[model samples]
Target: MAEDNFEAAPGGFIPGPISSGRGGSGSTARTANSNTLLSEQDVALAAPQADAVPPVIQTLRLQAEATTGVTRGSVSGGTTTTTPVVVSLANASTSDRPNADAADGDAYVDFGGLNGNFNAGSGEYLQWSFAVPAAGTYDLAFGYAFFSASATNRPMRLEVNGKIWDRLFDFTNTGANTTYSEAVTRVYLEAGTQTVRLTATGFSGPNLDYLEIRSADPHRIVIQAEDLLPAATNTTATTVNREITLPFLNGKTPAETFRVGAEGDAYLDWGSEANTLDIPVTATVAGTYSVTITYANGGTTGRPLTLTYLDGTAIGTFALAPTTAPTAYPAFYGDLVPAVRPADGSDAGDVPDQSGWEGWTKSTLTVNVTLNAGTTVLRLSGAGGAQHRQVRVRAGGGVQARAGRPIRHHARQSHGGREPVRRRDRPCHRHRRRFRCAHHRGLRGCEPQHPLRGR
Candidate 1:
């Protein structure tokens, strides 16, 4: 019998059965030839093309198998099965996954077996990519779950073009199976493809799952109070009040007028007047007054308005203006009093005398008369004893008087053979030699002469 030998080709080795040391039979030779033929065919198929490049495999797919509760690259000789997760990219600009080359069905690569304890503590995460359609604002949102752990500190962040868009979730000491959600405002995305990634950082426990993206719009302003009038100041004594025009007559404009009537005892009278021009004024005392006009865009714009008084007299018209918003034309007024001060000495009669002497009562009056420094005379009268009344005089300081006592001299018929004499205390005593007493027709001719008879 002849022996059969087979040589392996450069592409793959050919399998052959063990033979006895003696020569083989016809069946063994045929089997050896068959192996050799198959090897040769494989080598020919693998040879380089005219371009000197090996043939390219268009698609490649692989599935993970579970063994002993663990999935590995190597598997034992046993039956293996896998489920397919199909993913289709429509407007998607980018993606990050294994076996992305597979087109459909079981050709898709399987992500290795996921354990039940995947979360922050495991420091594990899955990432994906997306493309921005255009250069405009867009809103983005993300959702995922983490596993429970003693210190599950899982946090997720979003990045666009390698820049952190936002941090989605941050949790410490999370339970075994918890889910978290994150949302962000509308951001400006530039034109062209953008690399959007969802990263799980600070997670020390387990794995994360599931992420998605979508679109949104910007905000607007609808209400404004800029047209409302402000407060005005008045310097007049007369009550001159005005009304403010409603910038928005449709009633959508929110405005309030705070007028402190006039300073002293003044009050804001907001009756049923629709505008500032229509407000009626009651009588006010003569003085400088101020009216403060306060207006608002309600609570919307929160802008303050000012009420201004025009130039000239204090009794001019008032206008409403705002730092921002539409201008308003309201009523105005002028200062009540003229600015001039009255002149002094205008009326001589009105002037008061600053210098004058004051008088005392006559009952408290005293008289004082002094002779030369060497002599003085003091007189006492109205009380005396004599034939008639006589004035007494006192002298002091080296002066003397002829009459020491009270004396009287009068003319009368002789009594007891005494001759009639003139009374020295008579009113005519000083001129005794000038005149004599007259006799009345009676029993006695002349009695004691009295000073009361004359004068």
Candidate 2:
């Protein structure tokens, strides 16, 4: 089962502002739907506070209904609106549909509804003015729900202080509208009152709960699968942002799975040897760090993979273990034991289904890597078959080596490459032959004469 506490977006937590095509009902019926969106609260909105001599502010939350000012129609002649309708989580029973759950408080703003349960149309918008304590880049997120019948990719335009930040800010399917997910974007705010607005583009926007502002962590960087450099990507790699339905329990019933807990709810399906991902990353600290990758490998065995720097320095080589069995459901769902289906004698709906890609799972593995401070590209290559979501690099104690040995300081070579002047445990390959360096008085290995010459 995917960890219920999993909250990081698949495309790193702060994937700038999103603009994409990813392809949403009524009200009692609208009320029930909104209530359902509340129950599946995937992330905890309560920010953790570190104890200190003085209490420090952890997160600043602005409720949509309380803080937002609504406006409709043309900006020049739009009428000042009243407080938006705030919906509360419904009390549900075992027989009722999922009850609504709120991340911060009890109620959320009904951005997609008006009057009562009636559907809202385009041109309606909600704006909020909040004060920032400091001037810096912060992670901005919306706790929202969108469960509709006709609309899917309900687009919104974000304007900061009347300046358009993103014209097509995408709010992808959060599986069930009742299932609330945090959609994050990065923004630079000066320490003062800043106005932020979200207006529907073509369709009604998602039901919003609140807007959260938090400090960004420079030591950690997350790269979503869709954010992989297109110029550096292989043509064979395919990116998807939708729900997948597959057979379960001997094909008796079909299961619908979304990239739950994923940023943008998307993943990259590895196609072939040509499918390589070049991830752009910025390291705040230059040192050895650990990279935790969220990926799904459905093969029977592990898939071999190699991580390297853009210049071809090997970070590490390892295999990603399979996240699930190849079977569609039940039999293919590994050792999961759930209630049997009363009619078919198969596993009940309690069994976790494969969520994304053909065999996608929200599993993660951490590997150590050495990175230089500043912007750089990390490359992933090897035999294909694993679906990847997010790669999170965090500063900490980890391995520091280019190949399989520790990196040692040495004088710069005439070729501009810094040779590793460390003693080799075993004989070095011809391309990385060992030599006694006179300048450093230590063992050093020279780079291969040709880029493709070394083994």
Number of the top candidate by lDDT? Answer: 2
lDDT tens readout by residue for model 2, 1-455: 11112223322333211111110000100101111221111111111111111112378888875734433332322222333455655542342223235434666665534344223344467787777776555667777876656544554657676765544454655667567877665555557788878875334567777777776645556555544422112221233121121112222223223322233434454554443454545564567677656676646777766777655677776577766432222121222123312122345644344322333334333556666654555666665546665566766775354422345444456644645453332224443333322422233333332232222
Put down candidate 1 lDDT per residue, 1-455, tens digits, no spaces: 00011100111111122122221121222111111221323322322111111122222111111122212221222111222122323321244232222222212212222242223221122334445545443444333223343343433344456654333223233232323323222234555655544333322212222323333210100000111112222321112221222221113223232221111111222212121221111111111222222221212222211121111112222122121211111011111111111122434642111110000000100221122222111111111100100011112233322222223345475678976554432434333432333423131323344343332
Which lDDT value does model 2 have at 161?
69
Give candidate 1's error at residue 75 in angstroms. 28
lDDT accuracy of residue 282 in candidate 1:
13
Deviation from native of the Cα of residue 144 in model 2, angstroms:
0.6
